[model samples]
Target: MFLQITGYMTLIGLTLYLGLRPVSGRYFVDMATYYNYFQNYSLGAHVTSSKDVVFHYFMKFSSHFMTAHGFFLLMDIIYIYPLYLFSKKYFKQYWYYSFLVLIVSFSFYSYGTNGIRNGAATSLFVLGLCFPENKIKTGICFITAALFHKSLTLPIGAYLLTLMYNNPKTYLIAWLAAIPVSLVAGSVFVSLFSSLGFDDRLAGYLTGQGNLDVPVYTGFRWDFIFYSSFAVFAGWYFIIKKGFHDTFYFKILNIYLICNAFWILVIRAPFSNRFAYLSWFLMGIVIMYPILKQPLFKNHQLFISKIITVYFLFTFLMYFVYYN
Candidate 1:
């Protein structure tokens, strides 16, 4: 009980720290953009951003009463609070383990600060998954997430598809096949994805035209792909090899595979990390869910502690080494 309280308070404190960060683009990619937009909207500027219609109006309305820093606090609340709720819903008293996994995930800090909208939407997506039996609640969460960031369509669509067909083996096979396919015909997938017209920015990513101002990896990222493969391996190991069976795990694993497979096919695109995040956001739950639920290892507590250390170490390394 004490640890849980401590964890929750710590996460709450983190939300505040991130939200109130001094507005700058040095590392927080979208922080300055959000600040400028909020200032303009506060001055009675029109909210013309239709891509995420609801989110734009949200900012327009929020700016009327609060400074940009206050708005960031609100958004950070939206982004981080849901992790607590979702972990509580699933893990109960043991929720701290899941919460710790999520906060330390490689993309967690960056998403909370830089990809603010995506962070907010993905948090909603995780929360929505918590109440699968309640269609009304789930639908509302999913819809709101989409409005916050339309890129959520991929995962939400994958969830709907999972309802229709929940087959992990097939998805795993396809996910594996995507590597060689991507190596040989990555351009084909790019053209096909751009044709879908999900977002105009898809084209920019495909043509390496996105973020000319922001330097990012455009070529094949074998290291990143290798990093992402951990969830795939973990899922298959628990479900197929060890014969773990749970409806919720099935749903989560399938969605992770489907979404990660799409990223695999487009792994060479510019800002592909953004695409990878659609799946990476769920990596914590995907890998830790089964382990926490069933004692996969003999010394479960020690195992979890070690896993937490290794997981957070990835973020630590990225922050200091790669990000530097």
Candidate 2:
């Protein structure tokens, strides 16, 4: 009964938070384009030679704006259920607390509004993380995500590497080492993407085109950084003290942190803020599992949780009332 209440409360809270925002209707535009492109499969063949027949079929069948948006919403909801199952199975003791932490985090809002493929892909990746031992099943999940967005190839490739490494320490060390390389290679990566036939328009948007002084709502806020750092520390404590041994999730979290840290140093744009969502999403699992199981910081936990909740509420209200 408590679980049911929490779940409904979460759904209501998310709905109220997201529903009140002015729908820019950007997703509708993208969906329409996708639908049109799929409808012209021969044109799709001319555009890209890979078989995305399933994606094409879905778009073809669900051509209307309402149907497309409904599909997107359904995918978003479906993606989170596996996360719930994973949280319950592994961190049963702290599932509610963890869910609350995730709900209060602004990552959910950012992803929902972004209307980009990466956001959807990340959700599916989380679902994949929930089932580590089932490699074949996990591969299918990763492949499905790639169909939604190819950038996920990075994390999916990292998952495969994690399978190769017998020790988490090795994976961590390698990830740390790769951070500097990735930062330096970002320009090369951009060029490579351009050469590989990705739309320059899309690439420019992702990397942030020439600076325009715009009212940025999200980015590397000092507050977000502080909270993320605390969450990372909490994860470290949990793993070391409780011997949390989910190597796949740990590898994903470590890579995410390293990449975000590198991005913070190298990139400067509100668009870069997407990395925070990835960071916080994984951190939710890392931080909450420990807190749920031990409750060692019971008094401090509740106090901090309440403070965080109030802060999010204030920000949400302020954004709607003043910023909007």
The model with the greatest lDDT is 1
- Model 2's TM-score against the true structure: 0.67
Off by over 4 Å in 1: none
After superposing candidate 2 on the true structure, give the runs of residues whose Cα lies further than 4 Å from its correct spot.
12-23, 26-57, 64-69, 166-202, 205-207, 210-228, 240-249, 298-324
Per-residue lDDT for 1-324 in model 2, tens only?
Answer: 776677657765664444334334353334444434644643334344344444555555444344434555554564455566666666664465655666555566555545435566777777777677787777787888778666566567656655565454553454445445545565554445445654443354345662323345433345555555665565555566657666544675565555445444423344545444545556566555544555455596675477457647854864586456
Query: lDDT per residue, candidate 1, 250-283, as tens digits?
Result: 8898898889889888887777777889999999
Question: TM-score: which candidate is best?
Answer: 1
Screening candidate 1 with a backbone cut-off below 3 angstroms (N, C-alpha, C), the clashing residue pairs are none
Q: How far is candidate 2 from the true structure (C-alpha RMSD, Å)?
A: 5.8
**lDDT values of the candidates?**
0.87, 0.55
Q: Against the correct fold, how does model 1 do in TM-score?
A: 0.96
